[model samples]
Target: MKTLKLILIFCLLFLFTLSFAQTKGSFKVIVHKSNSNSSLNKVEISKLFLKKTTRWKGSKQKVEPVDLVDTSPVRENFSTEIHNKKVGAIKAYWQKLIFSGRRVPPPEKKTDIDVLKYVHENTGAIGYVSNSANLKNYDVKILKVE
Candidate 1:
């Protein structure tokens, strides 16, 4: 019985570790270099992505949030970390709004390059990309998330 208990505990620990690893994602929030705000809290970032805040403070530029394709791991991590929800839940939120003609979800890019390109070109755009994405050639800066 003691041996069986130990085996069960070991399996539980392994499952816990695996689950934790899956929830953590490597990503960085980025914006056009011209944006004055250097950092934002998670709530502020969430508001921007959710369209609750449509305009940049002290500016007339509209906030354009971009997302990675639904299947992308970066997108999954982003939804989990920033919105505290799964990607499907976020999609559902957008779907309800769209059904009512209220709003639409942010545009989704297929890859990190596309996202970087979009955010670099749009002054008010905000996006997240994989931590491995090279931003050196892009006219964008990473926004420190607090």
Candidate 2:
């Protein structure tokens, strides 16, 4: 009985550790290389993505936030970690906005490379991609999330 209990405890601890690691998904926020801001806190980032904030601070340039497809795992993690909401909830929020004609969600790209391309080409664009994406060749700036 003692040995069995010890094994059970070890298994539970392993499972807990695994879940915690999985919850901390990896991704990076990026913007056009010319964007002046170097970093932004989560709240600021969230506002930009949600369309609550329309322009970059201290600049007349309009902010063009982009999103990954609803089905992308990077989008799933970004929705949870940055927006503190699930992807489905985000979709619903955008749907209501579109129905009311208040706003539209950021354009969704199908892949990280596509997002990189968009951000690189648009001076006011901001986007996120999986951490594993090859950004070496892209002329984009990785924003530090505070």
lDDT values, one for every candidate: 0.93, 0.92
Model 2 agreement with the true structure over 3-38: per-residue lDDT tens digits: 999999999999999977775456899998889999
- Clashes (backbone N, CA, C under 3 Å), per candidate, total 0, 0
How good is model 1 by TM-score?
Answer: 0.83
Candidate with the greatest lDDT versus the true structure? 1
The regions of model 2 sitting more than 4 angstroms off are: 1-25
In candidate 1, stretches whose alpha carbon ends up further than 4 angstroms from where it belongs are: 1-24
Question: What are the per-residue Cα lDDT tens digits for candidate 1 across 28-140?
Answer: 99999999899999999999999999999877689999999999988988988999999999999999999999999899999999999999899999999988899988999
Candidate 1: minimum summed lDDT over ten consecutive residues — where? Answer: 18-27
> For model 1, what is the alpha-carbon lDDT of residue 12?
100
TM-score attained by model 2: 0.84
